[model samples]
Target: MNGYRFYTAASLLLLTALFTACQKSAPAPQEESGVNAETEIIPEPNAGSEKPQLTVAISVDIAPYVMKNATTGIEVDIATQALPGYQLNFIQLPYEKLQSAVAQDQADMALGVQKFKDVEGIFYSENFIDFVNAAITKKSANLKIEKVADLADHKVLTWQDAYLELGPEFEKLFAPDSPQRKNYVEVADQSEQVQQFWDAKDVVIVIDRSIFNAISQAKGHKLSEVDYASIFPEATYFKANFEEADVRDAFNAGLKKLCSSGEYAKLLKKYNIELPNTICDSKAHP
Candidate 1:
């Protein structure tokens, strides 16, 4: 009887061990396993990964190159067509503030910088456009101001923040006694100055030729010609940060393609701008 009981206990122990082994060997239930079990190995979500975005900055004041149309508050059709991959954001800053904005990373690029040497930590592409500076006054004033130095006794108005070298020239000719040669009243913007000149015939307004022409055409104002041409020889460019070499390269490639294909000429014509041959000769033509 004792031998039989020991055999029964050993047999029961062996059976329990086998049952535990079978449980351990059983396959786990996979939540994703279905008709297509191969697709169960899905990739894990990566929170750190993201697509890179390119940003470009431009000024809002330079007409034709940049301007706020009555229909569209801000127009960037040229840039949009040029840099299709970039996400463009115009900062609408003043000319003086544009350089600082790009340097401080507030903007990735600045458009309409005529001279590359003037800005630091920024790389400029080839010149796209040229501008001519001119003086405007009422038709009745009939001001015969020829050279920049000729506006000595007359009250002149120009953009306040602009670097108007002509002001100093006028001061040297007129107000030698006054410190800083206080010659004319500087206003915040060209439009304001032009309006001032319009209201007060005594004041003379100095502005860019393209702007003067557009304004005159739009408002039916008469623009008189000065003897001297204020055409700047340097061409304007799309300025990018020094670190953004790739973006600059892409833009240059696109611009070169556009120039070669005569697309640039089409753009100029679309804006009603006439390109002068003097731009290629490094000389200013009237």
Candidate 2:
């Protein structure tokens, strides 16, 4: 009986020691990873609210900005990083359809929109990037576009809906009743616009500055041989219209965070996109 009691006490002591050791051996909670912490999300709108997945509308087939083959682009990267809490649903469509997606309540935000002026039930976040536009001509043509009116005498090729996207001033200049409308052609494909310009079908092609540079580099256009008329002012791109104001506000907050954290610069580097002076200027205050 005494031996049995001794064994029981010894076993209890052993169990106690094991419990104490386990308490000491267990790991404390580890700090969140830098990337995870950096991307730490704020819950959507109201607490305990179950928000539907966010739909982000982007124009399809816009390379480097909205890639045709790849799932990611500059705007996609920014959106993904900025809105970490919501399950992003990208609805890729044509330029016109993209805006309609938001209007029809089919999308939460429209990516890469220049402006939403005069659009009802639509709001836009702070401008995140600038779309520098220009008029390009072949060296042989020597066509000069000193201003919007200068393009009246020359055949001009530009992306679809450019008249509306370029702002009210451009709208008036490219109005249906305006004589410039006779020579004005809005193409659906940017590649075709660049090709048409290179083929010398038009006197001038209106395109985004960075896009023109990329196409020019690929086609082996000599920098000295091509003239880019810096006529149009830069257009500011923004996240336009979400179902809820809080959602848009959250994105604005996240965008500011992204800019301040230098993640915006990193994204531009990753995509090989040149940082425009407009964006660079925004970084100063961010």
lDDT of 2 by residue, 1-286 (tens): 9999999999999999999999999999787766555686766687557545887887775556766532787778888788888878787877767666777877878876655465777776767666768888877776666888787788889988788766577788888788679888888777777878887844788888777776667678765777888777555354456657788888888887887888988887776676456453534421
Candidate 1 on 1-286: residue-level lDDT in tens? 9999999999999999999999999998756536354565667778456333544555545455566731121125545555667656566666556656667787676665444355555666654445555656565666676576556567766654433333445445535464434656766555555567667855567666665566556666655532323433332222434336676676667666666667766676777765454123445322
Per-model TM values vs. the true structure: 0.64, 0.73
Candidate 2 weakest ten by summed lDDT: 277-286
lDDT of each: 0.56, 0.74
Candidate 2, overall lDDT?
0.74
Once superposed on the true structure, which residue ranges of model 2 sit more than 4 Å away at CA?
1-52, 118-121, 167-169, 219-224, 279-286
